[model samples]
Each structure stands twice: as C-alpha cells, then as structure tokens.
Target: MVKLDGISSFVAIAEAGSISAAARRLHLSKSVVSERLAELEQHLGAPLFHRTTRKLSLTEDGSAFLERANRIVWEVQDAVAEVAERRGSLSGPMRLSAPVTFGRMHLGPALYPFLARHPGISLTLELDDRRIDAAAEGYDAVIRHGTVEDSRLVALPLAPSRRLLVAAPDYLARHGRPDSLAALRQHRAIYYTNRNVADWRFADVRQDVFVRPPAALRVNNGDMMRDAALAGLGLALLPSFIVGEELRAGKLVRLDIGHEAAQELIYVAHPEGRRASHKLRTLVSTLREHFGTPPYWDVV
Candidate 1:
C-alpha cells in the first residue's frame, strides 16, 4: 500500500522544484523529505526525479504522477474538513501571502478577528511584493492587487483599489499645482518601479491619457512613494489604500486632471484544482466582510 505521507511529500517536492524548498514548506527536515521520496520511489520501482548539482527535474513518471498526487492530497484535506465542519470546528494550517504594504496595513488587522474566531487553525502569513506561484509555494491563499491573468487559479475579488495623483500641500505650494496633464509632465514625479508600466494611465468618458513625468524619485514600495509625496519630494501616483488617510486629513491633496486614474481590483486567489477547505472559505468570506464595498481605507 502507498503511504499517504509519502504521496504528500512527493507532491510537495514536485511542486516546489527542490527538496530543500519542499522541506521548508512542509516544515520537515531535508533528510526526512528525502527518505519519504526515496521510499515512495522504491515502492513504485521508478525514480521520480532527475537529480543534478544545479537542480531537480521531474522524470516522466513524476510528471504523470503529480496531477493524481495533488488530487489525493486535496481529497484528504476535504475529508478532514468535512468532519470538522460537522463538529462546528476548524483545525489545520492556512498559509497565505500578500503584498508587504497591504499585508502590514490592512490584511494583518483584518485577519486578527478571523484568527480569534478560529483558535484551532494555525496561520502562516508571508508579506512579499513579488508575484508568487501559489501552488508551488504551498500557499492556501494569495492576496493580490491588479489583474490576475492566471487561469489556473480561482480569484475571489476582495475590494476595488484606485490610484490617484497626489502631492503634499507644501510641495504644491513650492512647485505649483498642475492644472492639466500637459502641465503635470513638467513637474518631478515619484515613480513606483514595481509596477509593469512606468507610465501612468488615466481614462474618462471623453478621452484616455498616459503620462510619463520625469522621475524625482524611484521606489519599489507604495508606502515609500506615499512618504516621498508627504515629504514634498515629488507628486506620486499612489493607491487609495496607501494615501486615503492623508488625503482625508488634508496632509495630501489629490490632483483633478479631468481624467480618472487607473483602478485595480484586489483579490484573494488559490489554485483552481485545490479544494477549498472550510477554513479557507470562511477566511475569504471574513476578508470580504471586513473590507466592505468601498473598503474602509477608501472611505475618503
């Protein structure tokens, strides 16, 4: 009989690309993971991976086995979740990833109450700005802002995020406020390098415009961009969640350039093939409820 533990370890190894990565995800020693894989391979009388000094690649058999392995692991999780649901309790680990700024400012606070309600569930939250392969990384859910084009994943919309051109009152006083998109191009702009498009795009009923102002400062994080704008460094195109409070308090002023800035949707996504456990569903619902229609951050 194939041991379920061996099958699970195989699935983790296949998805994670390396045993070391899989070990980290599974919270197991490398030796233990290796042993499990070796045992499984022996039972099947076939090598699962082509080992190399640089990397590990799945063998033909390993490639064929991965889909079935994922199904088996998901089915087991669902079985356990079914029983837990009947008992009115949730127990297991939920691994999640989100952008560093949003995770720290919003997602963390939103998750606290959910954690409080389900004391039986263990939580692992990773705050990262880079896009992640959720299945390979073994995340239960990934909170992302922007377009989710991965058809392999099921995306559940959390909230709407809009970007606005903003600057501090002092900065505007020093540099003069931009009355039009043309005037905006002459001023120093704070550029967020992490986004795919360097140019800012805006649209209205009448027309669409793209602006690429000269960069006074280039930053990878939204909070830093907001800070630069707050410190009178330069005008920044920043998301509402980052600058909404400052905008409301008059610390930062929004530029009315006729066209509305780009809007992106925030989503909590998981692999489509992965079965949603009771805990995962409840957490998604909790986040949606917590953020509300316009999101608490966008009230301004």
Candidate 2:
C-alpha cells in the first residue's frame, strides 16, 4: 500500500517548491523527507520532480499525479473529520497564489483575520505577477485578475477590477490635461511591462478615449509604476486598487475623457469538479465576503 505520509510529503514539496521548504511545512528533517519522496518515487517507478540546485518543479507524470494526490489527501482528511464528530474547529494547510500587489495590499491583510479566527488553519501564500498552473503547483486556490479561460478550474468572480487613466498634478501641469484621445496621445506614458501596453481599451461610455503614448518607463510591478507616476514621470493607466487613494486624494488626477476605463473581473479559481475541504471553503467564503459588491479597495 502507498504510504499516506509519503503522499503528504510529495504534496508539500510540490506546493512549497523546495525540499527544505517542504520539510519545514511537514515539520520533518530534510533527510527524512527526502527518504519518503525517494521511496514514493520508487514505488511509482518514475521521477515526480525535476530538481536543480536552487529550484524544484513537477515532471509531467508528477503533474498528472498532483490532482489525484490532492483529492486523496482531502478525502482522507474529511473522512477523519467525519469520524471525529465534526469538531468545531477546522485545521489544515492551505496553499494559495496571487499577484504581488493585490496579495500585499488586499488579500494578505484581509485573510489574516480569518486565520486568527481559526487558529488551527495554516496558510502558505505565493505572491507573483505571473499566471500559475494551480493544480500543477499544488495551490488550493489562485486569485486571478483577468479572464480565466482554463476550463479545468472553476472561477468565482470576486469583483470588478476597474481601471483609470491618471497622472500626477505636476505632470498634468507641465504637459497640459488631455480632454480627448488625440490630446491624451500627446503625453508620454508609464507602461506595465507584463501586459500589452499598446492596445488599451475603455468602457462603452469612454469609447472616445484611447491611448498609445510613447513609453517613458516600463515596469512589471504596480507599486513601482504608481511610484513612477507619482514622481511626475508620465500618465499611467492603472487599476483603481493600486491608485484609488491617489485619485481620491490630491496626489493624482483622473483624466475623465468620458467614462472610466474597462473593468476586468477578478476571480478566485480552483480545480473543477473536486470537493473542497472545510478549510478551503472557509478561505473562499472569507475572500468572497471581503471582496464583494463595491469591493473594499474601491471604498476609499
């Protein structure tokens, strides 16, 4: 019979991305974890992960095994919980992924209180701008900011990620405020390097508004882009989550050509057709509650 401990170690390593990290999560020594993984791989007759000095990634077979592994782990945990007379407190490790800025500014702070409420739940959060393969990476949930086309996952919309075209007061003073698309092009731009900077779209009411300014600065981080814009660098088309305070305060001015920019729906996604554990369900519920309707970020 396959050992459950080995499977648990495998899942931990996949999620944590390193032997040492996984060992820390399992509260086991590195050698013991390594032995468990070696035994598990030997039984399966294939290498589950590709290991380098600095990083570890799943092999193709490992990717296929991960989803089933998750199901097995959660099912066993649920079975025990049922036998335990449905204990009042829920406890398990939840792995989550999100964009850096959103996680730092919103998700992390909001979820910490949930952790306090349920002291038994353990959370490992990965914050990156790059899109992740949640199942392959062993994350219980992933927060995404745009269209989630992967049919393998169930996506629950969190909120409307509304955007705005804004510039610093000094920048507007020097370059003159743009009242229309043509005038908007006259100013330079601060670009977000990850997405397509050239093809910007707006809402229906703001159809007359368009921008393709020459890029003066390019950065992948929202915080850096916001800081650059605040330094009187150039106009920036930024999400309200990142610049909402600046727009509300006197730090920045929104160039309302006609209406707001296009709003992409943000979503929380997890593997489809799988039963979520009580711990995962709690996190999802907490997130939905925290980011509903107008969304907390847009409040101020």
Candidate 3:
C-alpha cells in the first residue's frame, strides 16, 4: 500500500514546482521529501516528475494521477476533521487569500478572534490584490470583491459593498462641487489603475451614465486612493468599506451627481465540489456574523 505521507509529498512537490520549495512548504528536509518520492515511485514502478536543473514538471503518469491524489488527500483531511468536530473541536490548516486593504483593515481583526477560539487550527493568509486560482493555489478559502465568475467555486455572500463618488471638503472648495454627471466629468479624479481607469459608471432610476474624467493621479491601492482623496488631491470613486470611516468623520463627502455608483457584494468563496472542512465552515460563519447584513462599516 502507498503511504499517505508519500502521496502528500508528491502533491506538495507538484503544486510547489520544485523539491526545495516543497520541502520548505512541508517543513521537511529535502532528503526526507526525496526519500518519500523515491519510495512512492518504487512502489508504483513509475517516475512522477521530469527532473531538470532549471525546472521541474510532472510526468504524464504524474499528471494523470494528480486529480485523484488531491481528492485522496482532501478526503483524508476531511475524515480527520469530522472526527475532531465530533469531539467538540476542530484541527487543520486553513489557507486563505484576500485583498490587501480589506485584509489589513477588517479581515485580520475578524480572523484573530476566530483563531483565538480554535487554537488547534493552523492558518495561512495571503493578502494580495491579484486574482488567484483557488484550487491551484491550495487555498481553502478566498475573500473576493465584486462578482465571482468561476463556476467551480461556491460563493457565500458576506456583505454588500457599494461604491461612492467622494471628495474632501477642501477639494470641493477649490474645484467646486459637481451637481450633475456632465459637470463631474470636468473635474480631476483619482483613478484606481487596477480597474478601468478612464471611465466612471453611474445609474439612476431612469438611466445609466458613463463619464470619462481627467485623472489627477492613478494608483493601484485603495488605501492610497482614499488617502489621496483625503489630501484634497481630487475626487475619488471608492468602496464604502475603505472610506466609510472618513465619510462619517466628515473628512470625505459623497457626491450626488443624480446617479448612484455601482454596487457589489463581498464573498467568502471555496472550491465547489470539495467537502468544506469543519474549520472552514466555522470561519465562514464567523466572518458572516462579523460583517453582518449591511456590514458594520456601511452602517450610517
């Protein structure tokens, strides 16, 4: 029989793309990982990897076996988790990813309390703005903004995120307030470069409007955009979660151009077909409870 440890090492090596990297991820010595791989290959009478000086890749047999290997590992883990749950506790690794701003400002706080409640749970959180392949990256869950397009994942809504057109009082004083969509197009705007930087979309009861405003600054980060707006650089279109505190504190004022900016939902998503471990379910529940319906940040 193939040992589970050998199979796990194979999966790790395949995902990580290198033996040294896999060894580091598994917290095992390179020799130990190599030994496991060698033993598994001997048992199967087939080599699993295409070893090279510059790169490592899976062989045809390895490619064919990968999906089944992943399923086996997950099944074993889920089985262990179910047993642990019946004992009134959970124990496992939970890997997650979220946008940098949300992770720092909100998700960190929400997760820490959950971690405190379940000390046996090992957590790995990656904060990045770029889109990721959830299963390929080995993340148990990912927090996403806007719509989830991948049908292979299950999205659980955490909160409603509404975008608002906003500016500092000082900026309005200098540039004058824009009362209509036409007037708003004439003002300097801070552009979030990650999205379409040239166009701003708005909707009213009767119609939708799109405007192209001259950019005063283009930035990739939401926190920086919020800061630029606060510094009276220019108008900014930002999500409520990022600027809600500033809006409430009178540092930033929402612009009413007779149309509302687009709205989206925050979601905690996981792979579709896999059975969610008890710890993952518990984390999702904690996040849902913490964010509430409208989210604490959006409460007026």
Candidate 4:
C-alpha cells in the first residue's frame, strides 16, 4: 500500500512548484520534504519531477502522478470534511490564479471580506498576466477576462466586463478624437503587449470589424498604459474594469465612434465534468450575485 502521508508531500511539492514553497505550505522543513519526495520516487522506481537550480517541474510521470495524487488528496479531504461537517465546519485550502491587474484592482479587494467570513479556509492567490494551465498547475479556480477560449473548462460568467478605447482628456483636447476607424491610422496608440497590437477589433450598431492601428507604444501592464494615457502619451484600448474609475472621474474620456465599442464577458473557470466543491461553487455564485446586471462598474 502506498503511504498516503508521503503522497501528500508529493502533491504539495507539485502544487507549490518548489520544495521550499511546499514545505512552507505543509509546515514541514525543506530537508524533510526533500527526503520524503526522494523516498516516494525510490519506492515507485520512477522520477516524478525534474529538478533544476531554481525550481521543479513535473516529468511526464510526475504529471500522471499529480493527477492521481490530486484525486487522492481531495478524496481524503472530502472524507474528513464530510465527517467534520456534522460538527459544523467547512475548511480547506483553495488555490486561485488570475491576471495581475484584475486580481489587484478587483478580485483582491473583493476577496478580503470573503476571507474574513471563512477564516478556516486558506487561500493562495497568484496573480499574473500570462495564462496558467489551471489543472496542470493544480489551481482550484481562475478568474479571467475576455471570451472563454478553452472549452475543456466549465466557464461561469461572473460579470459583464468590456473593453473600450480611450485617451486622456488632455490628449483628446490637444489632438481631437477620431470620428472613424479610418481616422485612427494616423494617431499614436498604446497597447497591451500580450495582445495583438497591430490588429484591433471594433464593433457597434453600425460597424463590426477588425482594424490594424499603428502602435506607438506596447506594454503588457494595464497600470503602465493607464499611466501613459494619463500622461498624454496616446490613445489606449483598455479593459473597462481597469479604466472605469478614471473614465468616471473625468481623468480619461471615451472615444466613441458610431458603433465601434465592444464589450467582453468575464468568467470564473474550472475544469469541466469535475464535481466542483462547495467552496468554489459558493465563490462563483457570490461573484455572480455581487456583479449582476452590468456589474459594479456601471454603479459610478
């Protein structure tokens, strides 16, 4: 029989990405964690992770083991929770991944109260602009912007978020706003580098199409673009959620052409066909209820 305690250590390492991180999460010493992983590999006669100077990544074997290990860990947790809930307690760790700006400006602030409500539930939230492989990375949930691309995940729309093209009031006052997509060609623009800077899409009642705008500056950070636009650098096409405050506060002005602005739906996503836990279900439902009908952005 495989030692379940040793399996827990492996799963922790895989989820945390390093021995030190896993050790910290599990409240174990690094040397002990390392030794346990070595023992597991020795017992299985196969390596689970490829170790390097900085971090660890799962080998093909490790990937397979992680999938099984995640199941085992969850099963054990569920079993314990089921027995404990008779005494009235809901508790476990939840790992979440999200885009940096959205997490920082939106979800981070929103989650504080949720955390306060459920003090027993531990949460590890990672914020990054790059997309993460949630299942492979062992993330419990992911909050993302834009249309859902991967159908393998169960995507639940939490709020109505949109993107808009805007420039500072000063920039608009100086250069004047473009009245058509054709007019945008001559204007300098700021863009999120991770997105296709050269090709942009616009849609409205009159026109729905893509435009290739000339890019003057490309940056991956929304905060940077916000700053650049505020400094009178160029027109920026940004997510409405990030710029909603500035737009409402008169620092930025929306450039509305006839039927050119488009809106995107945001979602909380997880792997499809899996039995989502009450914790995930609760958060998803709470967000949906909190932001229904144009979300908090429309409030101001």
Query: What TM-score does prediction 1 earn?
Result: 0.95
* Backbone clashes in model 2, listed as residue pairs: none
For the record, the alpha-carbon RMSD of candidate 2 to the native fold, in angstroms, is 3.8
Per TM-score, what order, best first? 1, 3, 4, 2
Q: What is candidate 4's CA lDDT for residue 7?
A: 95
Q: Pick the candidate with the highest lDDT.
A: 1
Off by over 4 Å in 3: 196-201, 204-209
Using TM-score as the measure, the top candidate is 1
Per-candidate clash tally: 0, 0, 0, 1
Mark the 10 consecutive residues where model 3 has the least summed lDDT: 198-207
lDDT digits (tens) for residues 169-272 of candidate 2: 99988989988767767889888877764436766634344447888898888899899999999988888899988888979888877656666877888877
Encode model 4's per-residue lDDT on 181-244: one tens digit a residue.
Answer: 7777768888887754332556643334445566768887888988899999998878888888
TM-score of 3: 0.91
Compared with the true structure, what per-residue lDDT tens digits does model 3 show for residues 131-235? 777876677888988767789999888888888999999999998999887897779989877664433656543334355678899987889999999999999
lDDT winner between candidates 1 and 2: 1
What TM-score does each of the candidates earn?
0.95, 0.81, 0.91, 0.84
CA lDDT of every candidate: 0.87, 0.82, 0.86, 0.79
Instruction: Tell me the deviation in Å of residue 76 in model 3.
Output: 0.5
